[model samples]
Target: MKKENIKKVVLAYSGGLDTSIIIPWLKENYNNCEVVAVSGDVGQGTELDGLEEKAKATGASKLYVLDLKKDFVENYIFPTLKFGAKYEDYLLGTSFARPCIAKALADIAIKEGADAICHGCTGKGNDQVRFELTLKALCPDMAIIAPWREWDIKSRDEEIDYAEAHHIPLKINRETNYSKDKNLWHLSHEGLDLESPANEPQYNHPGFLELGVSPEQAPDTPTYVTIHFEKGVPTAVDGKEMGAVELVEYLNKLGGENGIGLLDIVENRLVGMKSRGVYETPGGAILYKAINVLETITLDKESAHLKEQLAQKYADIVYNGQWFTPLREALDAFANSLAKTVTGDVKLKLYKGNMINAGVTSPFTLYDEQTASFGEDEDYNQADAAGFINLFGLSIKERAKLSKSWPKIED
Candidate 1:
């Protein structure tokens, strides 16, 4: 990578410490290659305000704030949710959003005719792998530059000092020490005391939460709500149709009030180290629960079982940053097939941080009242179980008899 030939470079800027410092660092190291800052608005509310102006102040030639919220929720979040994929029992909300953001950044780099695309992701985290992998999959010809891997600055303290010395305006306070990532789906908090798994997370620690009330602070009264779905995508709340963004926002308000979604886990990063993170996903949790409730009625037994197994694998694949692989696409096809019939209404009871299924109804429901009832008439016979059980257990019964005859003394 020759500095003299490099005319322009695109940077994945978050308006944070690392990225703010990287703009100047790129100029200092790359002989002042024109830096274009690209920020993706996946759902980080007001954090993006004045980003373009701020980028200019930081010595960027221009700034692109791409609004990918609709695409993010529709294309990435919903598809993963339809698979019921949860990485280690916590939804891969963050993992699912990364690739799409990277894609947006790469797309900007190509359209702007930048010579290279750079990212401020740390060396030890998963985002670097996710970002670089997207470039490899989508725009392989583009030069990839990762500042964390190449920069001389080694610590957050050093980066913060650089930002201060260079007059880069990043919001930092003594009260706010945790690193946070926020989008429309959820918010994730890591670093500081969270680096140690033994420490019980301090809610009093600033910036440790988003979108939900603490479980302890949740009201004792239960909140009941109905969520309607069409082809596995949530369409309404309480019988009113809404857009993807509105539906999620509605659910977030309801779920947060009742303390619905919060997760703390020590998860494996793509770089091969375990990191502790706390996530707040109030709306996503409600939607996942409501969708599963609908699927219970809609999906056939075999399809439901298979999809459950596939969900875990899907979660693993996404968590490992394999979003662009063929296997994930194939799995997505299967999930879509199963999701086609997942249309219905689900009523959930939210109380004390729990999402409880209250009622479910779907047009494609496979549940048969006659077969499942205790007072079933012609649909079933009591005598049929005798033969069926005997036939099914024949091999097991023979094996047990042989085992009895060949039994050895146990200690």
Candidate 2:
């Protein structure tokens, strides 16, 4: 709740080039504020292995590496998945993770008695908005320090050079050039060749497709997977119940083998510019298909139609980092209420990069075989249709007759 005198600052550290430079940058700018590096473990794997010691070596007063994989899957990913959210056909893999990570940073800031929270997100990226909005939502009093907007560095290369000049350790590897953000649900790749929409993504190596294989390299045989839902949340896969984290992991493996859930889109950033991004969201895509199938079987016609409309808006709200706003909360409530009847089991066949619906069943299904049957039946609804049609078309017929009586216009 203080002005500019920030005694301490907690940064959302990722042990990347940008964050490695940010520790020194924050210290240089903030009048000797203690830098507390906090790394969130959302399934970044070995990238986080040496992060704690690396943070200390990078001049962090303290390093806090919180393992949030469970929370990320259970609280953040699942809730968003309930609505089958996708931002322009790209599973909101990176969008939903930012708020939870930002929340973690803000929580640490509160606990550390830090006046400010720092993030390495650039001014031009969606993450800056995502991180700041979350900080505002959770800890409105906390000050924010965004180095990309303030620092003299012009590009990622310049930041890397700064890190090199400052003797910061480098953990460069084959997956180096392209900027990537990975988590349990999905992995997103941007920058470099991905920046150009015309450039066909070169999926040549192991880490090229972060989650799994490209469609071209996938196995020839199809893989079938069944997903069960209770009140719109994925409960099990192939009749086997598993925890949230494990469920996503399992789905990812199956979907990846089938070469499913790969997307390339040139999206309009929250900032002014447009950027092309390639996303691998195997698990998310499968879950979305399964849930949509379930909804079709269980939800009534009007609710299903309304949900389709709301789902897009919900994706936009989350994609635009408006998760904490009142409108988002109201929309979430509306989504949750609609999801109540969306309980069922969806059988899907995954073959050579395609997920085809096998079947779906639910107790609340509105599909009635007897009433819908064309053959002879005791329901006897065919004769009643003549009278119903007469009344239903009366207004239109009357209006047409009146139009004929009016003076004809010259064509």
Candidate 3:
């Protein structure tokens, strides 16, 4: 849509550097149009402080801070967990949060009678696709604006310069401007030294690893805890029931303290480029593993195998920003069905970035002690294995017989 047609625009604002500068950039470029800023809060603590006053001071007419943390965990995180989805061990932290944030932007746009929904996602990243696709899905005719693709400002330094000229108060400067995304599930760090694949992460750098310490700096003693799950969703820790937000927060603290979930990888982005990023997903790491440990005895061989295959596909769907599509809904349904049997308790020992399975128990466990016992029993028939082996190996035996005439065994 043309700039003249956009009398009002709703921006998917996060009080971050990219978005903080974007509020001013949109006004200067869009005929000084009415900018309504929507900050979808999914538990990025302290980031939302003084957001409304800041938004207005920066050129936004109004600000809407949507509290989606509980919704994000219950609706997005747990479903992905039940599906056992992981984008190359990433835990779908930033991947899944985009849709949640975009949905809020779309809703606020419609409510405010806005002509366009703008976002601060860059042209080079996956979030641009995630946010735009979701906004388009939810609001088909609403115009979408991505300032990074349209703006003349080429770099973060330029953005800071622009912000300073406009007198926009910012929490960061050019030196500390690492492109980051934080939410209830994880905190992702990109750019800066993390842009290089060969560089080792400064896990011990002060204030670098915001969530917690490195494994080397973690406490020596192990922390053991049992997580209770109902229908594949984590409900409690150490037998104490908690709400979705509380559960994740509690686990995040524990997992962070133990240096449990720090991932450094050069992942294949949806934009057909490899981007190196460091992720801190303390609680999410524990949740994913806990479900895997529970599913060990709860799910049967066929279901488990099929779910694993589907999980790979699901991970791709999420990573590619297809969250609101029918395919995602279908996969979620399949995951929900399989997860029905995934209710159980998983006991794990956390120590220095290691999660060791201590114990697992479920009422629906398929494991039978009697059937798996090594001792001889009156009901067991050892001689029956000969016929079973013959039937099972029939195809291999016939293939060998057919190939015998083709080549000598010695050759």
User: What does candidate 1's lDDT look like per residue over 46-124, in tens digits?
Assistant: 8898888889988999998898888998888988988999988778877877899889978888899889999988888
lDDT of each: 0.86, 0.84, 0.90
Clashing pairs in 2: none
TM-scores of the models, in the order given: 0.95, 0.94, 0.97
* Residue 47 displacement in candidate 1 (angstroms): 0.6
Whose lDDT is greatest here? 3
RMSD of 3: 1.8
Candidate 1 Cα deviation (angstroms), residue 103: 1.2
What would the per-residue lDDT of candidate 3 be over residues 308-404, giving only the tens digit for each residue? Answer: 9989999999999999999999988888888887888999999999999999999899988876788876666889999999999999999988997
| Whole-model lDDT, model 1 | 0.86
Q: Any runs in candidate 3 off by more than 4 Å, and if so which? A: 378-380, 407-411
Which residue pairs in model 3 clash with each other?
none
List model 2 lDDT by residue over 1-411, tens digit each: 343488799999999878988988777778777899999888888788888788888789989888898898877777788877777887788888898888889889888898899998988899999999999899998889888988799977777788888999877633377888888888888887777788898875666886778878888877778888888788889999988888999999899888889888888887878889888888888998888888877878888888788888889988988877898788778878988888888999987678899988988787778767887778776889899999999999999989988997899
